[model samples]
Target: MKVTLRTDVLTNNNKAADFNRELFESTKTLVVNIMSSPGAGKTTLLEETVRALAKKYRIAVIEGDLATERDADRIRAMGARAVQINTHGGCHLDARMIAATLGELDLDEIDLLFIENVGNLVCPSGYDLGQHHKVAVLSVPEGNDKIPKYPQMFMRTELVLLNKIDLLPYLDFSVEEARKDLSEINPESTLFPLSARTQEGLHEWFSWIEGAYVRCVRQ
Candidate 1:
């Protein structure tokens, strides 16, 4: 019964995702779905990404959280259009939720649309938000065990932004071990160790976005 119910839910979600993908393609908007645990620097990283690329590309974000609109406000402060989706205790943002927000933002004026999923490891990974790319944010303070522990999130994502490398000296996290573990779990996935606060190793992430945007628009 559980399996049947789950399958039915995903079927509906996928249909909604297809609708969103079609709209995104039509408007030439590069949509990325970002997932991470709470305090994993998802918002801060987005703020920096916006600060660096907003002038070159028109960026917009859909902030998801259980209760507050804080993340959306921060992204808006960076001079980008942002919409907040308060899940009200939901663990993840689904394709249907994303589809509902589409009308709130005029996709024609947007170059990039980033959907920041609710801050949870398990639930967020299972749902498809109809994005061109699904990226995961893992912080140094969260420790090395996270990559292997949360295999679903890492395996489904094409890129992993290993944030908080600036704290390498203060913490006991191992970058090489994370690389090894991720390679074992998802060999094709790319891992970038960056600190959103210090702006270290962020250029690679931004470049990835730039490349993806070009590819998306040219398609």
Candidate 2:
């Protein structure tokens, strides 16, 4: 019974995701779903991402957390339209939650939409939120073993942002080991080691986004 119920839930979620994809495609908006463990700098990365690209593109964000509208507020402070989805006790953001917020956002007026999923390595991996891309954030502080350990998350995401590289010198985290592990798990995926605070190696991420946007909207 439990298995059937869970499958049913996922089926319904997929339906909602299809709806969201159609809407996003119709509006020519590029939507990215960002996932990571709590404190992996998903919000800070987004904050900086918005800061860098806002002038060139019409950016919007959908911040998902178990509680608090803080992330959404932070994005709004940066002069972009943001919607906060409080999932209460839910571990991840579902398609229905995103579908509900679509009405609140003017999709035609937006060029990019970043959905910051509730920070969890496990729960967020299983849900489809109707995004054009799914990128995972893995911080240096989280250590090198995470990529191989959390295979589900790494397996599903095409890109991995290795945040907090600034702390690499002080900590025992290794970039080479991470690369090796990620290669073993998902060789097709690219890992960008960057620090949201110092903005190191961020331009590559921005360029990737530029390419993604062009592919999504123009091509």
Candidate 3:
């Protein structure tokens, strides 16, 4: 059965949008939606990012998974505010789901908001969650061929992170090929190649986030 939301619920989507926008504006938080396929190192990257910037900035995370508070717990263990959104059987997190969680967080105390969308290459790109930026994470093990197969996701990202570069030597992935493919799909998106585990090339990623936060604050 193809389940569908009611007309009233669809109509109320704007309310969610408005609420999210207002929350962001009032808090001046730089909300970043970090998206990618499962096992692409979204959580690992976020953990590294938080560790790198926590002393300099206040960070909060909203973790989305089909089921399990695991990701949220991980973030909380790091001393950051985190909330988990279990989608049950849903593949993605919509604006309304995000809007409903605003009350649970003290956004004013947060400088950055990282929403780790459910691990999927598709579906998540279709909706906007009132975020300032969308970062797409692609690991070397996933192959450089993903850009062509998932053009929509690539096209929508503001930044493309080529993660797990430390494994590049062990894998057959080509950095040049990945860059070329991404350029063909989205010539303007900024690309950062790094390994979240060993923290190689992480300085660039952290710098980008800091720059973005400054820009957001200035605006």
Candidate 4:
């Protein structure tokens, strides 16, 4: 019965995901779902992205959290449209949650939509929120073992943002080993190292978003 219930849930979620994908495609909105463990710097990275790219793109964010409108507030302060989804005790954001929130924003006016998934390396990776891309954030304090320890999260994502690299000198995290492990689990995935605090190596991240936007519109 447990298995049956789980299957039904996923089946329903997939239907909603299809519905969302159609809506996004019709509006030409490039949605990127960002996932990470708590304190992986997902929000900070997003704050920087908005600060730098808001002028060039019609950006909006869907912030998911177990509780709190704090993240959404931060994004809005950065001069972009943002809506917060509080899941109460839920561990992850599903397609239906996102689908339900879509009416709050004008998708046709948004060129790039970022869904910041509830911070969990495990559950967030399992649910499909109908995003064009899935990105994982791994901070320097989390160490290199995270890539191997949380295989599912790294395996499912196309890009891994290695945040907090500014602390590398103080910490013992190995960037090379992280790249190697991620390659083993996801051969096609790329690891991008950057510090959201200092904005080092952020241009590449912005460039990637620009490229994704171009590709999304052409399709």
Candidate 5:
């Protein structure tokens, strides 16, 4: 019975995900679902991303958190459209929650839509929000062992943004070890080490987004 309940929940979520995927594809909007453990700089990274890409793309963000509207507010201050989804004790934002928020934004007018999943390394990974890509953020402070410790999150995501690289010298983190572990777990996945604060290696991330956007539209 427990297994049955879990299956039913995901099955329903997948249906909603399909609905979202169709809507996103029809509008040619590039949707990226970014997930990470709390304080992995997901919001900071997004703030920087919006500031950098706003002129080139019509960017918007859907900020998911367990309670506060702080992250959404931060994105809006960057001059991008943002909507906050308070999960209210929910560890992850499911597909239906996203489908419900679509009406709040004019998807056709937006070229890039980023869904910042509720800060978590585990629960957010199992659910699909119909995003074109799923990227994970692992900070330098979080240490190198996280990739292997939380293999599910690393295994499922196509790209891993190694955030807070500015602290690399001060911290004991090893970027090489991270790349090695990720390769072992998910060879197809790419690890991008960057600092949202200093903008180091961030252009590579921006370039990747531009490429993703081009592919999203061409399809």
Candidate 6:
């Protein structure tokens, strides 16, 4: 079924933008929306990233899942303020959902806010949650063809994380192919290939994120 986005939805989305701008202006937090397919290591990356940067920067996470507090619990365990938004069968998180959760977070103490969107490629790409950047993750096991198949997801993302590179030797995936495809769709996006599980190639990821955080805070 084709879903036609109505004008009201667009208007509401604009309101969401305004809310996000106001919240960021008041709190001075850089919001990042992490998006990807299920089991693409969104939460795992968040855990690693939080562990690396939390001491230097105040970071919080709002995890969106279909129906569980599991991801949120994991984030909270790392000593960061975490909130879960259960979509209740919805494939994506809308702006109002995020707006509702704003009061629950202590924005004053946060320098970065990472919203892990529901595990889907299509729906989440269409919604604007007032984020400063959209970081998209593509696991190696998911194959190199995913870039062309889901061009919108890649095209809109500011950073593309080619995760699960540790499995490349076992799979038929080609890093070059993935890079080529991504270049075709989004030539300017910074791509990071790493393993969230083994921590391989994580330093570059950490550096990129830290640099981005510093830049955002400075602005």
Candidate 5 lDDT (Cα, 0 to 1): 0.96
Q: Write the per-residue lDDT of candidate 5 for residues 1-219, one digit (tens) a residue.
A: 344444565898999999999999999999999999999999999999999999999999999998988999999999999999999999999999999999999999999999999999999999989999999999999888899999999999999999999998898999999999999999999989999999999999999999999999999
Return the TM-score for candidate 5, rounded to 2 decimals. 0.96
| Highest-lDDT candidate | 5
Candidate 3: regions farther than 4 A off: 1-15
The local distance difference test score of each candidate is 0.94, 0.95, 0.90, 0.94, 0.96, 0.89
What is candidate 1's CA lDDT for residue 67? 91
Kindly list the per-residue Cα lDDT of model 6 for residues 61-173, writing each as its tens digit.
Answer: 99999998999999998888999999999999888899999999888889989999999999999888988889899999999888899999999998889899989989999
For model 2 the TM-score comes to 0.96
Those runs of model 6 whose alpha carbons end farther than 4 Å from true positions after fitting are 1-9
Each candidate's number of clashing pairs is 0, 0, 0, 0, 0, 0
lDDT of 6: 0.89
Q: Tens digits of per-residue lDDT for model 2 on 1-219?
A: 344444565898999999999999999999999999999999999999999999999999999999998999999999899999999999999999999999999999999999999999999999998999999999998999898889999999999999999999999999999999998988999999999999999999999999999999874
Error of 6 at 64 (Å): 0.4
Segments of candidate 2 deviating more than 4 angstroms: 1-9
- Taking all chains together, each candidate's TM-score versus the true structure is 0.96, 0.96, 0.93, 0.96, 0.96, 0.94
lDDT of 2: 0.95
Instruction: Report the C-alpha lDDT of model 1 over 148-201, residue by residue, as the tens digit.
Output: 999998999999999999999999999999999999999999999999999999
Residues forming the 10-long window of minimal summed lDDT in candidate 5: 1-10
Error of 2 at 93 (Å): 0.3
